[model samples]
Structure formats: structure tokens, C-alpha cells
Target: MAQIATAAPGWNRFVGVSRPIAAAILGLLALLMAWGATSDVGRDHVRVATSSSPHFDGLVGDHALYARIAQRVAAGESYYTTAAAEHRAGDYPLRPFVAVRLPTLAHIVAALGEKKAQLILLLIGGAAISAWYRRLRTEPDLPRAAAIGALFVAANLTQLAAREWIFIHEVAAGVLIALALALYRPARPWAAMAIVAAAVAIRETVLPVAMLFGLFALIDRDWRAAAGWLAIGLGFAAGLAAHVAALAAVTTPADAASQGWNGQGGWIAYLSFVQASSLLRFFAGWVGALLVPLALLGWAAWRSRLGLAALSIQLGYAMLLMMFARPANFYWAMLVTPTLFIGLVFAPAALAELARSLRGENAPNRATAV
Candidate 1:
């Protein structure tokens, strides 16, 4: 186990560990990152073909299906009824109700029309970027350069929000998650909590974020925030239950059941999943994979409440993808991709700090909380 670093007399904050332990952990992490960067674990297994354009013919099948469902919903069809029909026609699985996406995004598309819905999503993405810039700028421990890099990466990701991708549930939910994470303020948690609830309504996969928020709130002994997150979780549970029941009502024995999500693809799958979903998708496999660990290291160096929370959430999802997601399920990375590259901004400073620690020097600019 690593020993926690001690703070100075007037300092209230400390970081991961003493220099030696930090060196050992950093070394191991470096080796792991290199191995993952070079390894082609799930490279051969990724189903979608890549292209210069983020949206390619390979990804259009699901988008087309979603579009059809939205059209029906807009034409006065019940969401459950339209979704079941679409699934059966497309030979998509409906056995597990979760396979049928929550009707939230479809409803939004139906109500707003695709063009307007896409506009709203882009606006949300823009807001998330602005919010992130503000959050990073204000973080006491984060270096100025790191904050700018994070903002740049975030702004770049906005370009990936192609209008055609509007129908994809993950795109909207991912932006919303980004917004929620950036919007969170210790003094005013209401907006953040509400945004998380909205994300849950869009994608069931986002439920873990709500739980994570609740856990972090409790750890910080912020009762009101914890209660709000708990309420969102409970509400999501009830909504999910109803969604499941609704699916069952329309489902028949003949409906196709999912083969299963037990991929156990391990680190390869997790890294590959992330590579395919985020801006990393635009880079070569090895180059992108290497960034994964650097980003984590950056977050580790942060040692603030927001940093810890961000790190925990990313790792939690990484574990899930490693254990459960198949190669085709790489898109699930969208759940965490909104803030994924933000860590890259801090990687250089983090590396410098590690060097300082190794030289028996105390790192400065540490903070207790965001």
C-alpha cells in the first residue's frame, strides 16, 4: 500500500503518496499504458469500419432504425408500439427490455424534429464546453496550461456532434453527462442533479453516474446533494421498471433475445471501446491507447474532489466495459467520453510533478477540493 503524502503546516491538502511509492506506481502504470497502447487486443474485433468522417456507412444502420422509430412516434404512434414494430422489422433484439432504448430521446426528436433536436444537442455540447472551461479555470490545483488544453480538447469534440448522429442516444446523453459534471458546484447542486436525471431519462447506461454522484456526496458528507442524487437514482429505478414492464407487455416469445453481454473482453475491449468512441477514434490505435493512461495519471495528480470524482467515474466505466461489453458495444464509451480527453490537458504537469516528487521536492498548487 502507498503512504499518503503529508501536507505542510498551513496546507489542508495532500496527494497520492510519498515519492518512492509514487515512483513505483507511476512506473507500473507507465508499463501498463505502453502495453495497452501497443497491444491489439480487440482491434480485430471492432465491427464498425473507420473513415475520415466520424459517421460512416457502418454506423448508419442504428441511426436509420432510430430515425424510423422517431418518425412513427411523431406520427402519433405509442413509443412502445412503434419501438416493438421497428425492432421486429429490423430483426433487432427485444428480449431484454433494455435492448429497446428508453423512449426519451426519440420523443424529443419527435417533438422537436430532427434538425431542431440536433440544434439543441449542439447547444448542450457548447454549454458543456463553456462550463468545463470555467470549472477547470477555477480549480486551484490545476495548472493554467492544463485547463486550456482540456478546454481545447472539449471544444474539438463538439465537431464530432454531427447532425446525423443526433438520433443516437449516446450522443445526447454523453453531452448531458458532460454538462452535468461541469455544472456541479458544491453550493448549488440542483442544476447538476437535474441534468443527471435528464441523462438517465435518455440512456439507462447513465444510471451509474447518478449512483456515483450519490456516493461522492456521501463521502463528502454533503447530505443535500446526496439526497438529491439518491432521489434521481430511485426515480430512474422506477422509470426503468416501468420501461421494462412496458417492453414485456409488447414482447412475445418470438422476439429476439440478446445473445448476451458477457464479453469479458478485458483491458483490450475497454481500451478499444474508448478508442472507437471518443476523439481518439481519429488517431492511430497505439497513439490513442497511450493517451488513455496519461489521462488517468493527470486526473490522479489533480487530487481534488472533482479530480477524484472524475477518475472514479472513468475507472468504474472502464471496469464495466472490460467485464461485460463486446467489441460491437464500443459505443458504450460515449457514456464517459464527454470529459475523457480533458485529462490529457493535465498529463504534462502531472509528469513534471512526478519528477519533482522523485527528486525529493514537494509539489505545489495542491488543493483540498474543487
Candidate 2:
């Protein structure tokens, strides 16, 4: 019996370890299936349409700009000169111009075709998901329950959809921005700043993210880290200013009409209709369906003093986006999506704790079970 008991404990420990590993692997498989299904759908739709139509083209203007930049790099042209000339000529859209100058990611996408670029993005998405899972595993309040939240965020439908469509700045930005917030707890402030910088450069609509990072530093009373974030913001502003100046100098006022600029309000209206058309189309629907339970887990974590500040920062940024910006698409809010998912992860754990407390008060004589 003694030998059997000892072996049983060892067996239990092995099972405990294996279970989480199995869960993680399963979660990853789910993510891959979701991604593959969406990608196939997108390919089918594209195949049916005329390739010459701009709408059917996988990577349009900015994508073409990145390709040209890569071709120039392959031919031994400096990145700055190539980027500057493109800016002056108004050869690419504003968002792509900013993204292409960022060297690391731009070069990678430029070196590879659009399909390969998407695979790279999927890898990054996987990394972000894995990071969240790691963080959840260590959480004291709801270590086991947190996995549910991690899975929800990791295999989010919108993320899967974005992955299939190449050249999505918001999708990439979401992962990087989440990574930065996740890093802040480890005291790796410089690394966090770099991630935030990359996110802002991808999509200026999420500039609020840089400010939120600064706020996190201040709230933690880390002045040096706060200053680092400020420096990144200043650098971004300077580059943007220079680009704007060049654009202004080269283009006649009337040419702005030919630049294919659509008003943001119209885009927002279109996005809203898209959201109404399908349950899956609404970004929030994914949150409600898959992420709400995880958010409850996050709420539990917040009560336990694990991720409160990050939660606050994310919520504040979301409110700011809703009020101030007419988002070009539902994905513009991607920067906060991970944080929101984190919140979802904690929500259920928090509710469970609450239920236990209420039961304890209401039925003091009854045995309480976890």
C-alpha cells in the first residue's frame, strides 16, 4: 500500500503536467484550424473575382509600395532615400509609408511574398498567444481557470480572419501592443517601448497606446521607463512631421481628390452594417461568445492585484477610441482586444470567488467546495 501510494502521487504529478501541455497543444490546434478555414474562404472569394480589380487584389497600394521598397533594397538602394522618394511622390498610402520605413518588419514582408508575410504574422500571433498562456499559468488567483481565457484570446475569430487577409496592419499591431503590455510586469521597460513604437508606426489610429504605456510607467512610479516611452513618441512625431511636410510640398491641393481618400465616417457606417449582417462580423460578438468567460477570469485577477493597471489602461484606451476617432474599420480597436480578452479571462474567476463568498455567508454550516 505504501509503495502504491508513492507511485500514485508520482503518477498524479505526471498527469498534472501533461494535462496543461495537452491543453496548450489543443488550443494551438484550434487556432490553426480557425486560421486555415478563414484563409481558404478568402482564397475562394479571391479566385472567383477578377484579379485586375483593385478589390480582388490581395495587397493593394501600400502592399505594392512595400514590394517596391523591397525590390529597391534588393537592388542596393538606401531605405531612407527609397522611403523619402516614395513619400514625396505620394506613391503609397499614408499608413503603408509609415509601416515600410520601420526596417525590421517591412524588410521581412518585402523579402517574402504577401503569402509568406501572412505566415510570419501568424507566427507572431502564436507567440503573443503563447505569452498570454505563460502569464496565465503563473497567476495566483485562478491559475487553472486562466487557461480558458488564454484560449479565447489566442484563437479569437477576428484574429483568425485578419490572418487570412494579408497586409492587415491592425492584426499585427494588436499582437505587438499586447506583447508590450504583457512585458511591463517583468520590468523590461525598453523592450515594451520598442513594441509600442512598432504598433504606433503600423497604425497611427492607435497612438493612444503609446500614451497608455507612458501612463503605466507613471502609475508604477518608474520615471525612467516613462521617459523611454516619451522618447519613442517624440521620434514617431518627428518622422510623421517630416513625411507630412514632404507630402505637402509635392502635391497640389486639387490632387488630394485623386488620392483615393475616403471619409472615416462612411467607413465606420459600412463597418457597422457589416457587423449587423453576420454574428461573426461584429468584433464584440467574438468577445461575448468566446472571451466573456475569460474576462471574468481577468476580473478575478484584477481583484487579486495581478492585472488591474493593465485592465484600466486597456479600458481607458477603448473609451478614448470610441469617443474621439471614427475608426476606419472595426479592427482599429485591435490594440485593446488582447487586454479586453485578459479582462474576460479574469471575469469568471472573479465571479466564482464571489459566489463562494455569498455561499459562505448564506450557509455557514454547509461545507464549501472549490
Candidate 3:
């Protein structure tokens, strides 16, 4: 038998089981990943996002393409005109309708200017930090961890300050999603709902998150919250309908169709995308990717509504990315970035607790809903 590792009292929450069970689950995860990598499908998962291909190759890269559109829109061109022209000229697809970004972000960037828009994004980041701190500070089981929570929020958003990355729609949407998660208080859910609505307006990808919120509210019997979430979904549907109409007016039969998103890229694809989307991208590939699972473990360790919600959202996105995202869609990880890495802060305690359980030590780990 191995010696038991001691877990910090305040951070030790039952991860729904004793440590040995958690260890076994983690072990199984490792084995599955190893087995998955032995196949071409699994190997392909790490390829799209991590390929050494040039990003600004002019003919095929997205960064320069988005920057060009942002510039033209800022110069007073109609979004549809600029978008259609740019996509056609850049050889980007237009047939999927969704391939053309919604006009909300372009119009906002044009009206506010990129710098101001970036500042607003920064403010959203700050709000996420503040909201997370306030929410976690109230948790008696996570003492001294509130500041770390704020730090993680800040860390996840730090990349937003790069002006070069400002135009990526997922950047703003992801941060807003994080803030919404942090702002959610069962007693008063309006603020979070409003923020989610705004995020969905910016990026359609956020729709899934809004639906998750509605599901949680319904499960809790929080009728007001559920209705609010439902309203956001319906409003988004109307907006999308209008968007489709607008697209039809601009799109032509000759416009190119997307190559499609069914990558079936596997877990490596999901983790690679996660690495690209967060600060983890700055680290060595495998090291950065390792944090993805640890962060997931941290989320799993918490027993509260917030923990479960965050874990579910992250997992749902993981499955979507693994099953449907194209290689170039690695940036889709941004859909969960604002809230994903924050779980890393809790991972050490989780591992320690798991170790203790493996050593057959009984710790006074209680489950908390806060």
C-alpha cells in the first residue's frame, strides 16, 4: 500500500466518490486515450489544430481573412457586402449560411471601434473575475480559493488583450459565457440570462450554453430562470431566421459550400483545440494538453450546481468538438475557454484526495452544493 496524501481541508470536496474510484476513472481515461491514439482517427485529432501550416498564408488562413473583413467593416462598408466579397475573394465558403459570421459583431466593432470594443471585452473579463470571486468566496468548502478563482478567470482572458486576436467572435462569446456562469445566482438569474442573450447575439455557438442554462433551471424547478432561458432561445431563433433571410439576399448559388464539419477527430482533437483556445497554447503541446484533463478533474471534484453546470458544458463542447468539428475548427475550444481552465486551480486537491483514497485513508470529505 502507498502512503496517503493529505488534501487541504477547505478544498477537499467529495468528487461524488471515494478517492480509489476517482483514481480508477482517471486511469481508465488514460488507457482510453492511449488506445485511441493507436488509430488514424485518433491521430487525426491532433493534426488539424497542431499542424505547422502557416496561419496567414493569404490563400487559406483565417486570421488575415478576419482582419481584412474587420478593417473593411470599420471603414464603413456594409457587413454583408464586405463579408461576401471577402469570403469569395479568400476562397472561404458561403453556402452553409453559418459560414458567414453574424453582422452583430461587425456592426459593433464598426460603431465602437476595435480599441473600444477590446476595452469592453476587457471589462467583461473583469466582470467574470469579480463574479467568480464573489460566488466562490461564499463557499465555505473552498476557503482561500476565491482569489485563485479570480486569477483563473483573469488567466483565461489574458489572451484577449492581444489586439491581433480581437476580431475572433469566439473570444468575446467565450468570455461572456464565463461571466454568465459566474454571475448565475439561483435567487437572481436575470443578470446571467441577459449576458447570455448578448453572447448569443455575438456568436451562435453560445446557443448551446443558453440551452444548458435552461435545462439546469428546469431541473432545479426554478421556473423564472427556466422561462428566462427559454425566452433567450426563442429570441435567438428569431434572430437566426432574420439572419438566414439576410444571407439569402447576399448569397448566390455559385457561392462555395463549406467542406463540412464532421471531423470525428477524436479526443486528441478536442484536447488540441482546448490547448489552442486558452493560455495553454503558449505551453509545450503535450504539457498544455495535460491541463485539459486536470481542469476537467477539478470541475468533477466540486459537487455544487455550478460545478455540475460547468462540467456539463465543458464535456458537451468536448463531445461536439470530437465528433463534429473540422480540423480548422480548433478555435471552437474558445466556446468553453472562459470557464474551462479555471478548474485547474482545484486539480491538485483533487489528485491529492484521490491518492489518499487509493491509500485507504478516510478523510472527512463532505459534499457541498455551494
Listing every candidate in turn, what is its Cα RMSD in Å to the true structure after a full C-alpha superposition?
A: 5.1, 11.2, 4.5
User: How do the residues 133-246 of candidate 3 rate in per-residue lDDT, one tens digit apiece?
Assistant: 888777656655444667767877887898756677888888888888988776788988999999999999889888988888898899988999999988999999988888
Kindly list the per-residue Cα lDDT of model 2 for residues 1-370, writing each as its tens digit: 1221122111111122233443553354345334433332211111111112242234444444445555576567765666655544543333433333454445555568657777766776676677777776655433344555566556452453443334446567777776766565636678767877887776665577677667778887888988887888898788677766654454444332322323233322322322322233445433243333334334423532236556565555445543443323344455556556556544433333334443343212222111
Residue 92 error for model 2, in Å?
A: 11
Which of candidates 2 and 3 reaches a greater TM-score? 3
Score candidate 1 by TM-score against the native.
Answer: 0.87
Clashes of 3: 0
Q: Which candidate achieves the best lDDT against the true structure?
A: 3
> How close to the true structure is residue 108 of candidate 2, measured as C-alpha lDDT?
54
- Supply the global lDDT for candidate 3: 0.75
TM-scores for the candidates:
0.87, 0.61, 0.86
Q: Per-prediction count of colliding residue pairs?
A: 0, 19, 0
Report the backbone clash tally of model 1: 0
